[model samples]
Each structure stands twice: as C-alpha cells, then as structure tokens.
Target: MFYAILAYHVEEAVAALTPEEDAALMTDLLQINERLYRERTLGPAARLGATQDACTLRGPGAGMVIDGPFAETKEQLLGLYVVDCATRDAAIAIARDLRRVNPTAVYEIRPISLYLPGVPFPVTPS
Candidate 1:
C-alpha cells in the first residue's frame, strides 16, 4: 500500500531557533531521508515554500485567483512523502521515527488510492 505522509510545523517556531539548532535539525532530517532512501521506502518527497508564497483560486466561472494558501492554520504543511509500506502500522512507525528527530513536527498519514479503467488494484503492497 502507498501512504502519503504530511508533515507540518510552525514557521515562527522554526524561525526562532538559533542557527546551530537549525543546522542540527537539518542534519537530522538529512540522515532520516538518507536512511529512507537507502531502504527504498521513501518515494516522492519535497519541502514546500512558505504559505506566503502560495496562492489560491476560487469563485464562480473561471474562479478568482487570490494570494495565500487555502487553509488558515497555526502549523503550515512543510513537506510530504509518498511511502510504500505493507500496512498502516508500518506507516505509523515511519511517522514515529520522524517524531524522534522533530518532536514539534506534526504528521498525518493517509493511504493512497488509485483508479484506472482496466487496471486492477492489488491486495498486496507495492
């Protein structure tokens, strides 16, 4: 099964950290990412730009394009990963590992479902 892991963190909280603390956090992140890549558990992953750089489109007809993100939340979504795991428990384990490095970070794990006209969905993990 494929799971999407959403990672969230408060921008201000991160900005308040000292340069050394930030470097340590980044090093921890790189180590975790490297391990995941080596294990082939990490699929597509990327850090998103700040919410201020995001824009939203809404309204009738063609829809109005507006500045800012779609949601207003204390913690912004900082990054995500598409991990292929055997079960939900396995996915949770990955999240737990991330928590060890970034205790303040929040994660949301959700299964990925795909549909095709003729392709059959497999019962096993990919």
Candidate 2:
C-alpha cells in the first residue's frame, strides 16, 4: 500500500530557530530522505514554499482565483512524503522516525487510492 504523510508545523516556531539549528534540522531531514530513497519506499516528497505564496481557488470550474493564504491557522503544511509500505503500522513507523528529527511538527498519514489512467472516479453529491 502507498501512504501520504502530510507534515505540519508552526511557522513561528520554525522562524524562531537559530540559523545553526535550522541548518542542522534541514541536514537531518536530508539524511532521512536519503535513507528513504535507499530503502526504495520513497515516492514524491517536497517542502512547499511559504504560505504567503499560496493561492486558493474556490467555486465552480476554473473558479474564482483568490490570492492569499488559505487559512488562519497557526500551523501550516510544511511538506509531504509518499511511501510504499507493507502495512499501516509500517507507515506509522516511518512517520515516528521523521517526527523524532522534526519534534515540533505534526504528521498526518493516509493511504493513497490511485486511479488508473483513463479511469473515472465516481462522485456522490453531498
């Protein structure tokens, strides 16, 4: 099974870190990513740009493009990792290790349901 791990952290906390501390943290994350790649379980992973750079589009097709942060929450989504694992337990283990390095962050692990090319997804109206 494939799992997507969404990482969230308080932007202020991150901004408060010393330059050395921030560099060290980034190094640790790089090591973790390298290990994941070596284990062959890693798929896509990336740290997003600052929330200020984000834009939200709502209502209908093409929608109304709104330029600004999407939410008023203190914590913002930092990044995500997609991993192929044998079970949910295995995925949780990976998340635990990641949390050890990034102690202040919260992670949400969810299984991925991939659709084949040209396959249609069934949508039910609320």
Candidate 3:
C-alpha cells in the first residue's frame, strides 16, 4: 500500500524560521528521506511553495480564479511525502519519525486510492 503523508504547519511559524533554522530542519528531513530512498519506499515528495503565491479556481465552467489558498486554516499544507508501506501502522511510524524532527508540524497519513505515474520530471533535492 502507498500512503500520502501531508505535512501541515502554521504559515507564520514556518515563515518565522531563520534561514539557518530552516536549513537545519531540512537537513533532518533529508536524513529520513535518504533512508526511505535507500529502502525503495519513497515516492513523490515535495515542499510546496507559500500559499501567498497560490491561487484557487472555484464554481462552474472555467470557475472564478481567486488569489490565495483554498483553506483558511491555522495550519496550511506545507509539504507531502508518498511512501510504500505494508500497513497503516507502518505509515504512522514514518509520520512519527517526521514528527520527531518537526514537533510543531502535523502529519496526516492517508492511503492512496489511485496513483498514476506520469512523465517523470527531474527534481533537484532541496
């Protein structure tokens, strides 16, 4: 089974991190990512851009294009990780590992119902 680990964090809190602090956090995260990659369980993982640069399209037809994100929650969806796991417990364990490094952030784990691996794109690791 494949799981989607949605990472959420308060935008203000994340934006408040100093460059050094943010780099340190990314280093910790990359350590775990490296492990996953070695284990061949890692899939598509991405750290999304800030919501201030996001836009939304709603309603019928072409819909109304609006600036900003779709939600007004305290914590915005900051990033995501897709991993192959045998069970939900295993997925939760991965989330726990991530939480250990990012204690203030929230990780929502959900099984992927369907996945289509389209054309792959070269991604430079952050």
Candidate 4:
C-alpha cells in the first residue's frame, strides 16, 4: 500500500462555516473517513495543529532543539491526513473528492517515503 499526505490551509483557503454548515461538512468528512477505515486501506490520519506548535529538532554538533512557529508564508498548514492506498492516482482521486465536498478549502496531495534503517518504506515506485 502507498501512503498519501493531505495538507491543507483552513484559515486562508477556507471560509469559516456557520454552525449548521460546520455540522454538515463534518458529517461528510466523517463519512469519507469511515469508508476509508472500513476498507482497511486507511493508515493513520490526523489533523495537525498550527505551525506555531511546530519545533525544529536536529542534531548539529550534538543536538539542537529550537522553539518557534514555522516561517511566515502565503498560508499556514492547518491540518494533514495520511492514508493507505494502492496507487498515487487513487490517493489523488481521494483528495480531489475531498476538495469537491469541501470546496471551502484548498488541499494538496502528495505521497510520502519512510526510509527506516531496516524497515522499507510502505510505498514502492511504480
């Protein structure tokens, strides 16, 4: 299975929904999530926090931990969702479907590579 990254910017790309609208959209998102979950094709999906909640951790001379928000940009990364799929096209279709249902938001879809020391990445090149 291949893993996909669904990144979106809510504040900029989407308008705030009314209470009723919020409920409806959430229901739709939930339904989509349910379908993916039932198929066993879903891996771990999550909605990320603000970039300010981000931290940079890297090993320089020893190790470095810096605190601060992500650099300013045109838009902020508001959330993310990871899913397991059979192909990039499948993942792309899912993202497109999501966009159609949530026209208020703009999202990007990309596959990820996890190169563990021993374990192979979940996805392989086509």
What does candidate 2's lDDT look like per residue over 16-40, in tens digits? 8999999999999989889999999
- Order of candidate numbers by lDDT, starting with the best: 3, 2, 1, 4
Residue 100 local lDDT, model 2: 98
RMSD of 4: 7.7
The TM-score of candidate 2 is: 0.83
For 1-126, candidate 1 gives per-residue lDDT tens digits of 889899999977887899999899989988988898899888877778778888888899999899987656789888888888899999999998888999999999999896222455465552
Q: What local distance difference test score does each model get?
A: 0.85, 0.87, 0.94, 0.67
Best by lDDT: 3
TM-score of each: 0.81, 0.83, 0.91, 0.68
Model 1: per-residue Cα lDDT at residue 43: 80
Candidate 3 residue lDDT tens string, 57-126: 8999989999999776789999999999999999999999999999999999999999876697797785
Colliding residue pairs in candidate 3: none
Point out the higher-scoring one by lDDT: 3 or 4.
Answer: 3
Q: Using TM-score as the measure, which candidate wins? A: 3
Worst 10 residues of 3 by lDDT: 117-126
- Evaluated against the true structure, the overall lDDT of model 1 is 0.85
- How many pairs in model 4 have backbone atoms within 3 A of each other, for residues 3 or more apart or on separate chains, i.e. clashes? 0
lDDT of 4 by residue, 42-121 (tens): 66666665566688777778688888555465665656667777798888877777777777566777767872224445
* Order of candidate numbers by TM-score, starting with the best: 3, 2, 1, 4
